[model samples]
Target: MELQVLVLRPIFFFFFFVFLTILQQSSSARVLTITKPDRHDYAASARWLVSQNSWGVLSTLSVDHKGAPFGNVVSFSDGLPEKGNGIPYFYLTTLDPTARNALKDQRASLAISESPLGTCTRDPMNPTCSKLTLTGKLLILEGGSEEAEVAKKALFTKHPEMMDWPKDHDFRFFKLEIIDIFLINWYGGAKPITVDEYLHAKSIKLASFL
Candidate 1:
């Protein structure tokens, strides 16, 4: 009786509680769910924003706009839902100014926000609504290469419409070779997440920030 009551019973309850806690945490990390990470966790916050958002503003050195900064709304993918690879891939048409400008000059940036995920209680511009800007060379992927195949899978899995886009429209695959990162998820201004930190991030965790 003493063994059962003093050791077994308490141990059983402790394991049960731990199991329940893990289940709840796992449920919160679902693909479509956008529970923001801790504000101080800059890398996780940036990765979370990139993984959750399907579209963003792609800024480039505009050929049409006479060298001014040009921003175009575009759809992109980092990877499959919860298992993103942390690099934004775009399916673009050369007929559009974005791809056209990128070809002329590779310097570019993609900005994404958490507001589209529908988890932010504050205004879209509110500090709590995380945002990330990835700056790098926007390079076009070679057709039929291995990385291009990965790009195709990542894009098609996220944006099904791309598979049906007009094949003759010069739509092609592109990726942002991120060299800089600027993120903001809380009140203290942009968080310092490095390009290496963002790309190698396997998951959104505070420890992954390093």
Candidate 2:
């Protein structure tokens, strides 16, 4: 009886180990499959990515003798569409030459990226930065426009420090009428998304969160 008990104990332990190994592999496979984002979800993720960033690289065409690409760090605010509208937009205050050049060219791109926060250093192979580049026409608002007012309020709400600046400062309000947005997850392929598509995606995500 004693010998039989010992033999059964070894068999039970071996099966238990095998069962746990199979379970672990199954969970790992599910995780890998779930990480892929669909078109709509990718757009929503892009908007969420922009919302999380406060600073971004504003790329513009040079107005000087050389028609080079100029990039500058700028503080920006994302615009939420009106009650029924589903367009993606953003606003920023700029008086820099790059901004002027972009306005003249009417084409510009903003790259918003977020780095992982915490004490741990990021792995080089797997960077902690998530980026989204939004391409659009740069429109300057000088005179009174309802859209201008709405943009100003949104900007102030996000960055109250801008309110301390003098009213006559060369800093002017500029809006980016987003035509296409591309999100690169860890420097992957550029996923193209339209304004309406992004908004619709965002609505779905918000619903899920609620």
Candidate 3:
């Protein structure tokens, strides 16, 4: 009886571990990081990605390519972390083609990803990793305007280097007037999130606590 007990205990433990692992995988096919909000909460997920990420691909209609899509890596801010208004703001200079192209054609898009958060275990392109693309007119903020003031504070607080950039670089504050928001946060297809949903989505910290 004693020999049987010892042999069965090891086997029991092994099977138990396998059961737990299979159960875990089944429950969370796409694991949400400890810092990340639940994927089902699409609005919160989208807002979290935008607020946490400092950089993304800003896509614009190319001037040199006669309307080919041009995507450039750029730094941006959505207010101060948790205090964000959900609208992405950029500091750009006309010396760069992104700002130059936006001037000619207001149509533009900013694509951000959750991969940068260092939470995703899968490939960056994997749907479970999550990605957001905000499409809208990229409008330049008027200097000395109220919105511009907010933008300046938002940008400088997040990226201090912008403040010390050469004054003659023609650097200006630009914002994505998001007309559409596309978000993929799970195994399912794109979530049914709108610009309003994303803008109004509360901070992940608040949402999780509530």
Please name the candidate that would achieve the greatest lDDT relative to the true structure.
3
Residue-by-residue lDDT tens digits, candidate 3, 1-210: 999999999999999999999998765543232367788888888888877788999999999999999999999998865578988999999999999999999999999998877788999999999999999999999999999988998899878989999999999999999998899988878899877878777645532211
Q: What lDDT would each prediction earn against the true structure? A: 0.85, 0.61, 0.87
- Answer with 1 or 2, whichever has the higher lDDT: 1
Choose the strongest candidate by TM-score.
Answer: 3
Ranking by lDDT: 3, 1, 2
Candidate 1 lDDT by residue in tens digits, 147-202:
89889999998889899999899999999999999887889888877877777765
Which regions of candidate 2 fall more than 4 Å away from where they truly are? Answer: 1-40, 80-94, 116-128, 186-188, 204-210
Backbone N/Cα/C clashes per model: 0, 0, 0
- How many Å off is the CA of 54 in candidate 1? 0.7
TM-score: model 1 vs. ground truth: 0.80
Clashes of 2: 0
Listing every candidate in turn, what is its Cα RMSD in Å to the true structure after a full C-alpha superposition? 9.3, 11.5, 8.8
- By TM-score, the better pick of 2 and 3 is 3
